[model samples]
Target: MLDLRSLRQNPQAAKALLKIKGYDFDTLRFEELETQRKSLQSLTEELRNERNVKSKSIGKAKAAGEDIAPLVAEVGDLGERLDAVESKFHRLQEEYQAFAQSVPNLPDASVPAGSDEADNVEVDRWGALPEFNFEPKDHVDLGAGGMLDFEAATKITGSRFVVMHGAVARLHRALIQFMLDTHTSKHDYEEVYVPYIVNADSLYGTGQLPKFAEDQFRIDSDADFYLAPTAEVPVTNIYRDEILEAGRLPIKHVCHTPCFRSEAGSYGRDTRGMIRQHQFEKVELVQLVEPGRSWDALEELTDHAREILRALELPFRTVVLCGGDLGFSAAKTYDLEVWLPGQNQYREISSCSNFLDFQARRMQARYRSPETGKPELLHTLNGSALAVGRTLVAIMENYQDGDGRVHVPDVLKPYMAGLDVLDLG
Candidate 1:
């Protein structure tokens, strides 16, 4: 949520900044609503003053043995008028809040002005794209050795799902364990386990409720339960409506959970393999830090995600998301694209973003500032340490042999029961 004062004081400037993110925010409507709210507030205050004076007169008349019926009647009328005005005032405030919530965050000045992903700027690349003597196969073709089964998943649930078996299933689970262990032991993130279902307020705090309703799976329950879209939603909401000491300014948490998405807008994209799935597992990293340190923390968090790819020896590059491609609650974002020899291109494996208090404002997550002894919004950041399913896809395609066997990455061997290779023999 934007600061109402900022919108009221300089709406034009806010509009200009928001336009860069491709959001044509209506400043005029907001201005009109604000004006009405101010006017109503003044009238409400006036009515309260009139009521106070009438009540005083009633008390004085009663003390003097004079009839106070008329004064009491006038005060009652003032109360009725005040109630009407105050109700309208509150309704207008809610309207303004809705408008503000619909608008996306203003992109950081450093973000490139682009309309789409094609204009995103690549920052760095690591390792070499793997080469195969035989024409490389996609994950679907590579997994035909009885380890990956989509037919079973389709019958059990529907499309955009997969059932892994034997060594492949073990590899999938091993990937999640490896990621959690690395983040907890080496990256200094406290491991967390959160619920797979959440409420509407949690979604709103994470900027997913009103805007992306179609993309969520809402359970048919009394409490309006919705399946978690990502671990980011639940873990970040842990600090919602909270104020923390300055000493606890930075809180880092790593969570692993199954994410459910409707994939509403994506009609015919990445419909093959596990690239785009209704259900997928992810190792999520979230941070709440002092505002001043968030930018540096973005860099650190992006590197932390890249560390997973590095450990798996996967070739990948980092790209800064352009203004138009930035998430609704993120001022800036970095997407880590891992090399997929099967697809002959780099595919996004993780997205690290610095919301820079955008979500903090929505969630009311704050911390006391030592300098001022007042509460201030802390910057919130989250990134996929790596999407576990997609990491498995990358490994399958990159590590496949000419004979169709998939070689497990050495880093995951210990977790894979000391099996260095996944053979379907």
Candidate 2:
């Protein structure tokens, strides 16, 4: 929710920012509504004050043994008028809130201006793409050594699903565990286990509701609840509607969970392998920081993701999203695209964003500043440490030998119970 003061203070400034986001919020109408609401509120208060004065006069007249009937009747009539005005005032406030919710956070002036992803500029690329000897197999072909069964996945559920059996299944589990362990130990992130089901408020707090609900698997209801599309949903909402001490300025958390998505519009993309899935495991990182620290926190969080990829020797690049490509709640975003030989390109595996209090405003997640003894919205940030399934895809394709076997990454060997490679014949 935007601060009501934004419009009350400067409706024009709000309108200008909305334009850059491709939104033309009717500033004129909102200004009119605000003015009308204020007028009604003032009148309602005025009626109450008058009723109080009338009641006081009635008491004085009764004490003096004078006629109080006229005064009493006037007070009763005022009470009815006050009730009517109060109801009207409440409705006006509701209308104002509804309009504000439809408006999104203004894009930070620093954000690049563009119309679409094609306009997104590459901020930086990390690590070089690998040079392959022979024509390498994609994840699907490499895992087809009979353990990774896409057909079985489809039989059990539907498309964009995979059933890993035997050693492959173990490797999948190992990857998630390894990620959680690494993030918790070296990254200073407290491990958290969150719900797979979340409410509409959680999605809205994370900016996934309203616009992307179609991409989610929602449990149909007016009290809208949806299967989480990512651990980001539940983890970020852990502090929803709460206040904290400034000492807890930056709350770092790591969550590992299975995500569900409808993938409604992506009917034809990543149709093979686990690259695109309705269900997949992932480890997410979320941070709640003091407003001024969000940008530095974004850099640190993005690096935390790259650390996992680097540990596994996977090449990747980081791209900054353009204004048009930015997520609804994010002022800025950095996407880490992991190298996938299978797809013959880098694929986005994680997105680290600086919401700059955008989510905090929605969730009312605040911290008390001792300096002024006032509550302030904390900046919220979240990133995929790595999507476990896609990283697994990267590993299998990038580490496949000329033979049918796939060598596990050196760092992941311990998680595999000292097994260094997976042999599939």
Candidate 3:
């Protein structure tokens, strides 16, 4: 949620900033609501004060042997009026809150202006695209020999899912382990295991609810639980409604979890292979730092994610997300797109974002300031160190040999127990 005080103080500036992210802030409506709220609040306070004075006078009149019927009636009427005005004020406040929640975070000034991914600016590139001597096949074709089974998965569940067997499955698991190890050991992130299911408040804290409801796999229960869409959601929400001590200024956590998405808006895109799946694993990185340190944290976090791709020796490019391409909660974002030989293009493997205080405000996650001795909202940042499935796809496509065998990246060799190649028996 945005700071209501800031919005009220400078709605025009807020409106202009929001426009870059494709949001049209209705300043007129907001001002009207504010006016009504103020009027109602004043009236409510007056009525309560009048009631208290009238009630006291009634008692004084009774003590003096004077009839107090008029005073009693006046107080009763004030009570009724106060109730009505208070009710209206509460409803209007709710309306205002809903409106505020629907607005996306304003993009950072550094973000480039664009409408979509095509306008995103590539800031850097690492490693060279591999030259395949043989025709490169996509993951589906390469993992065809019972290694990546889609038909069985379809029979067991549905489409947009796959079941990997033997070495391929082990390799997928190895990628998760490798990423977790790299982030925890080298990147100085503490590993955490979070619940795969979360409540509505958690979703709202991460800016996923009240907007992208259809894109979630909601559980069929009265508890209003939903499948975790990303480790970022549950991981970042660990400090929801919390105020940390100044000593714990920077908190970094690395989490590996299975993510579930309904893909409600994506009806027919990337439906062919593991590129888009309902169930996939991700190694997520989340950080909470003091307000002034978030931008630097973003760069460090992005590099941590890039380190994973670099370790795998995968060619990739880092692109700064345009204003319109930025995620709902992110003030700024850097997407790392890994080269896929099969797709013949770079596909997003990780998205490192600095949400600033956008998510922290929603979550009410804060830290006490040493100077002011008052609680202030902390900055939140999260990124996919790497999506396990996409990383696996990149490995299969980029490391495939002419004989259709997948060579394991040297970094993952220890995790795979000396297994160097994935081949069908």
**Candidate that scores best on lDDT:** 3
Q: In model 3, which regions exceed 4 Å deviation?
A: 49-74
Instruction: Report residue 312 deviation for candidate 3 (angstroms).
Output: 0.6
Ranking by lDDT: 3, 1, 2
Local accuracy of candidate 3 as per-residue lDDT tens digits, 121-175: 9999999988977799998899877899999999999988999998999999999
lDDT of 2: 0.85
Question: Which lDDT tens digits does candidate 1 get at residues 298-345?
Answer: 999999999999999999999999888888988999999999988899
| Colliding pairs, model 3 | none
lDDT of 2 by residue, 1-425 (tens): 56778567887897787677677879789889988988998999899888888888888999999998887776666777888999999998888777777777777777777878777778778777877788888978887778889998789987788888877888889888888888899999999888899998999888787667789998878877899999888988989989999997689999999999888988898787788899998899999999889989999999999899989888888888777788777778888988888788888899888888878888889999888899989999999988989988888888888688889888888888878888866
| lDDT of all predictions | 0.91, 0.85, 0.92
- Model 1 bad stretches (over 4 Å): 49-71
Which ten residues in a row are the worst by lDDT in model 3? Answer: 71-80
